[model samples]
Target: MVCLRERMKMGKRSEWVAFCFLCFSLSLQTIQGYKESETARTLKLEQGDAHEVHCSRERSKAAWKIIEEYLMPFVEEERYQISRRCRLHSDNDLYRDQEQHKIHVGVNEWQCGYCRKRFYGENYLDQHFDNRHYDLLNVSHSRCLADICGALHCDLVMDSVPRKTKCNPAAAAKNQHLCESLADTCFPVNGGPSAGRLHEFFLRQFCDAHTCTGGRKPFSRGHRKTRSIFYLFASILTLMLLALFYIFIYMHRRGMKGGTVELKRISKSVQKKKPS
Candidate 1:
């Protein structure tokens, strides 16, 4: 009986040891996997930056097809086609004339695809689209698109795809998992690309590449102007306060002198009036 009890205790001890070893191995594997993923993401970012620089250098001379080929792997197919079209329309006068004839009745008019509304200009169309069609168009896909592009270290191409009647069920189902995986591998927990970040990135790139009317300025000119105005107003206010302070001091001194003079005059009168 005593020998059997001792063997059972030994068996339990061995099982506990095995469990701990298994847990330790899993933790080590997880750590290594995380490190490898981080390294890969860093490499991808470096490569993307190099690609962007090359694109910028060749942007003036390179054909749309060549640019598309270079960017195709990094962006979605729909986005690539839209970007290609936009480039062609902007660069080729013939293409622009043809598109304008087909799409615009006037020099500064465009039709909205969703509501068939006529807008006076491209900016108006853009604003209308954002206000009226943004939710109906993007829905759930925007988040997935942003996360995927972020993970791939690519720019998010906007206004590329048409509005969908319904959200993509498959994409919706997998979006959470994809976001989590991307966060773990490509971005920090707080730094992952959301819809706003993707929009910001697109706007920055657009401003850098094109010269659209009223587009965002590269140097934060508005912010600088605001700061300058604030400083000017503050300086004026300080000067005004200093002037008021000096006037108050001058008036107080004058009042004191007047009071002293009046006292001297009264004393002189009293002395003259006294019997001498």
Candidate 2:
């Protein structure tokens, strides 16, 4: 009866152990499944982020291509038309005769009121006003005008009165003078006005605020010097990297050679001992 009771107790202990093992196995499987699910969720999120970035990059590329292919030519053509119109009006005999008669009649010869300097025409006077009195004009103006005229120095004009009709030749010439003056200020002649320089100036001045930086800093000798210095530093860094790589290769080859010599010496010594 004692032995039978002992056997029954052993059987109970074995059953309990099996139950505990089964529970532990189930817990481990549950923890592993949770980890796998979390990992998959994280990977999916990363993939979504990567896809978004790729789409953004593709859109940017497409936009740049459109600007380069279509928008640039259109801008160039508009600039050409502006420049041609300015040239034609500037050379007009009727306008020149009118200005000459004004000067002959002692009508002040289109003089700048601020500087008291005389100009041959209204265009030159407008240019002087833009170059010299731009700051004063801005402070004097009570309100800002809408950018409908597409002139850079139009901002300097104190008139906030809206126009009901399209600007005539005289008004257009005045706007052109303003544009040219602002262009000169923004893009000073490094030598002289080469082809397309004026166009670039106009584009910079009249471009959308969101697209352009407003010609804040003109390209100058200082920028060129800075670029040269940067290139010099980059070249020096590349040469230093090459030197380090060469040194690493040399050291690795020397280490291999030394190991080969040591092995050869050991093998020879073993052979000698065996023959003796």
List, residue by residue over 23-94, the lDDT tens digit for candidate 2: 999999999999999999999898555422111222222333333342334445444333322321222111
Model 1 deviation from the true structure expressed as Cα RMSD, one decimal place: 24.6
Q: Which stretches of candidate 2 lie over 4 Å from their true place?
A: 54-62, 70-276
Tell me which residue pairs clash in candidate 1. Answer: none
Model 1, stretches more than 4 Å misplaced? 54-276
Tens digits of per-residue lDDT, candidate 1, 116-163, equal 788788667655644554444322212122224322213222324644
Number of the top lDDT candidate: 2
Query: What TM-score would candidate 2 get against the native?
Result: 0.28
The local lDDT score (0 to 100) that residue 228 gets in candidate 2 is 51
What C-alpha lDDT do the candidate models reach, one value each? 0.46, 0.47
- TM-score of model 1 (CA atoms): 0.23
